[model samples]
Target chain A: MEAGKRINVVTKILAANDRVADENRRRFAELGLKVVNLISSPGAGKTALLEATIGRIRKDRRVGVIVGDIATTKDAERIAKHDVPVVQITTESFGGSCHLEASTIRQALDEIPLKELDLLFVENVGNLVCPAEFDLGEQAKVSMLSVTEGEDKPLKYPLAFQVANLVILSKVDLVPHLRVDMEALRANVRQMNPKVRTLELSSQTGEGFDAWIEWLKKP
Target chain B: MHEASIAQNVIESVLRLIADGTVQGKVARVYLKVGKLTAVVPDNLQFMFGVLAEEGPLAGVKLEIEEVPIRVRCKACEEAFEMHEEIRLICPKCGSADTRFETGRELLIDAVEVD
Candidate 1:
């Protein structure tokens, strides 16, 4: 029988992923590495924000990154320019999986010297959907949304905004040229996630980068 | 895309329960109670489950998704109603946006109808 017709198939799958995720979490704790899963829509400025964050924070803390992309090692290469340890997971190798699974993340971490890093940032395959469902033993889940992506993103992709503890509104420099309604975006985000902290800044302009860096540095 | 990952999480949780002797069997059905706000799309998730469960111990298990619509209980008038559409947080009966949500933000395995 096809599993879709009569089965509680989604539940079984989530249950299974949670099992491995727990294991991944336990291992992450043992290493004392604060894992932060960065998620956003494609071109929502996740890579740019990370580049800026790493440039400033790398001096004070030991950092590493695992970049997830549908194809190409481009992101990994971009991050490597900052001189941090990085690995790229190309999902095309695995039959076009959109989100990185706990098992895949586990394998990726195995190749990294976890003991040498203070923080490990797994830049999820540029997606706002599936990435929120899986836990990679991260200390915090940060969602990056660029202003150019518009304010309606919070309502449209409520799942990511709700799960996020910190929401970084990136590409703020474009706000002058773009018609983004900042107040509406903020209000929408607050409506969905009452407690989520919001930061507005541009990675290109180095605006609000300090506050973001300081927040991440906190225990 | 994330549905596949979600499917993986469900499998792991069930196996853990089974390993601990809390549940026994070649699995039957897994029931999840997801809040309407959760990022999961049931249709996409259902599609991914079939692919993920192909060769695992849960090869033949069923995945049932029950989406709990956003229900808010107004603090002022003490009323509860379903939040069906758009991004309105105001209580329809009281017209107050000050209502507190009691549930529907959850992504949990409420029950496992196992065999």
Candidate 2:
């Protein structure tokens, strides 16, 4: 070995994770499943939205959910009440992983009936930044922002908004009470991602769920 | 926060490379190219890498990071530019809202220097 010799190894640091994510993507495709990775900050209404979404779509489409959390199985329990196949991935055992990686998703898939479901939702751990960096092999990455969290979230956390395929303004029913500007939020999201779709909905009142369901049903 | 996991991944990547004979001898430094858009804090990443690599063959490995700026191309006018201040996707040249990111999402291990 020569002194101070350098080798060019231009590759992704997360290459291993990315490879597994590609595998998960293939698996999803083989099962003809539309996979969506839902990302958001804590208390952003992901579970509530899923409960509402499953209630609406379960009548026509078979749905499954993989919920990731730092400690509790509370989210998985919530989704399981909807009578859909649900898997809880508690990251506390995995060194409290802040983000749900591809390998985790791969393992969770074994617990669910993949072929029997028309759609699968990976409710990523509630943290906008880390989850945006990890690819869970989902067809779409739907990032959520509640009106209660304020409109500047997209600007403050640009990467989450930038990577999102669809930005959902959750808890919109309480917008009138909050000082958050909905239009500014949409504009901020657009500033990060020009072509990404935006939607507003409230799981409490089911205000904009029709559009959400319609978006889900799109080919 | 997530830098610990990322640092672990970097170590794993280097170890794999060494095991496969792509990286030879004592690893001295690992060069990384992280895009600005990535939420990674370089200082935190360096610290975590040092801690994670302390007991292994990568002990005392110096992690050198090169941050790449966010760059985007306008779809309407076909002009490209780099964003220095705030990351806005709109094209600076044509002022078109239709634009796409060209760079700044990278998280690559560019190369390594060994003794």
Candidate 3:
């Protein structure tokens, strides 16, 4: 049968990773925990936003965080200040993956006291392109886009905006210091993903944080 | 960047098919349909596929990637359109940001040719 079998198979390239993602989803669903895969480009303020969000919302909601990185444990250390159960997954062993796969999330889920938390924030490694392609079994995909990046970022990285459930425009307090067009950024995001909700936030000054705090509390 | 890993995944998938010992000869070509919105550069992915698919059932196998353009349906006017330019997604007719995408996020292998 090895001469000319010519069998046809239609398969998705990411099927293995996606299988683990679905498993992670079911696992979270069983534990009654909501998972949010937070993605962004480097220096998009994902860590600071998580720090601020966890600091504010952890009082009312039990939150757990899993930080994914290529080589550093620094972000996990930053989030540890909130006195929450934080797990760090470093991809250095696995060829330093640019994005977090569901298997890594599963491993991290095993490390954390998942049942004790209401929400689990899986902070994906900072990359606009790759992270948006993988579903880490999160209930929602959030991207923190810093105003310093540029107004044309949404147009350049449309997949990130397109897949995001919420695109937080971080570092907006610095808009005055820069020539960034905030209106154009928001409009581009709205045009890219009309279903995505957006917010402007500055983790430094805590401006426009109340809405995010409230958003976290909603069922 | 991730295309190399993605290309490896594609090869792994094809190798799994021939592992059953049904494939007749050396795999000639693997036909793939990748969406423009998936962020996969066809040339880059094909390059990686070439490097990784060596020394196996997939050795010298050509990767044929069919790029699909982004198609959307305007939520306001209910009109469908294909967008080729990388710009703000707006309905040419109704100018609505609230448009639903019909296609352009696929990354799948549709068929394989085995000699």
Candidate 4:
């Protein structure tokens, strides 16, 4: 072997993941199912929001969930109470991947009744940064930030906000008690992603959830 | 962090190249291009790569990373420029909020040096 031989192999690092994601997207489209990838930091009310969403939309829309967590089937158990088919992807067994990759979701899809569900929510493992990097073939990527997390989160974690199709300011019911500035938070999110739609809602209070439900119903 | 997973992917990619005879010799270095918008921390990626490469054909391989700056095109004024100080999507020229990223989310293995 000769020294200093250079091979120009320009290739996307996540090509395999992206290819799987594209296939997932096609599969979802063919099934006429709307898939939403929910990303957030820990304790951002993703499961609670899903529980609320399922309660409201279940009457008209058949919903299924794929919950990704570092460990535990706790979230799946919670969603199962809502009587919807839910699958849990525990990353701990698979080297504790911080985020859910497309391949993981593809495997999870095998357990889901895709033909019966109108909407599928993939509750990504609660981490803002890593989840944004991996595309999961969702029609929308919704990122949640709680009021307690601080107003500067969007600026600090710009990539998560930049890629989000919708930014949900969760736990808005606690805003009055906290020192966090809602205006500043909104402005920071806007700075990172100008075109992203934002909604301030508290899953606990159900305040501002009507808009969220409406957004979910959009064609 | 996801850098570990990314490092594994990088090693796998190179190994695949070698298996297919795309990469002929033992790899000395892997050159990666990561954009500013990517979540990867270059230092972390390098560390992870070194650790994960210790057992494979990529053992003792040098990981070279080139950071790519964020560039955006203003939809309003059609001016394309690089974002320097901060990653605000607003256009610098037109001051318009309607702008699309041109080159910032890149995560690619550009080339490999073999011996």
lDDT of 3 at A57: 88
Clash list (residue pairs), candidate 3: A2-B24, A3-B24, A4-B24, A5-B24
* lDDT for position B3 in model 1: 61
iRMSD (1 decimal) for each model: 6.4, 1.1, 2.9, 1.2
| Per-model DockQ against the true two-chain complex | 0.27, 0.81, 0.55, 0.76
Give stretches of model 3 more than 4 Å off: A1-8, B19-25, B75-78
lDDT of 3 at B88: 51
Per-residue lDDT for B17-68 in model 1, tens only?
Answer: 7787666655777788777766578887777777787888888777678888
lDDT for residue A10 in candidate 3, whole number 0-100: 69
CA shift at A75, candidate 3, in angstroms?
A: 1.1
- Where does candidate 1 stray beyond 4 Å? A1-13, B7-34, B50-64, B73-81, B88-101, B105-115
Error of 2 at B39 (Å): 1.3
lDDT of each: 0.79, 0.91, 0.86, 0.91
For residues A28-143, write the lDDT of model 4, one tens digit per residue. 99989999999999998999999988999988889999999999999999999999999999999879999999999999999988899999999999998899999989999999
Which ten-residue region of model 2 chain A has the weakest summed lDDT? A1-10
> lDDT tens digits, residues A24-127, model 3?
98988898888888889988998899998887887788999999999989999999988999999998876788888878888888789988999989999999
Candidate 4 runs further than 4 Å off: A1-3, B78-85
Docking class of 3: medium
Residue-level lDDT of model 2, residues A1-219, one tens digit each, is: 557988999989999999999999998888889999999999999999999999898887899999999998999998888889999999998889898999999999999999899999999999989999998899999999999998788888889998888989999889888888788888888888888889989999999999999999875
RMSD of each: 4.5, 1.6, 2.5, 1.8
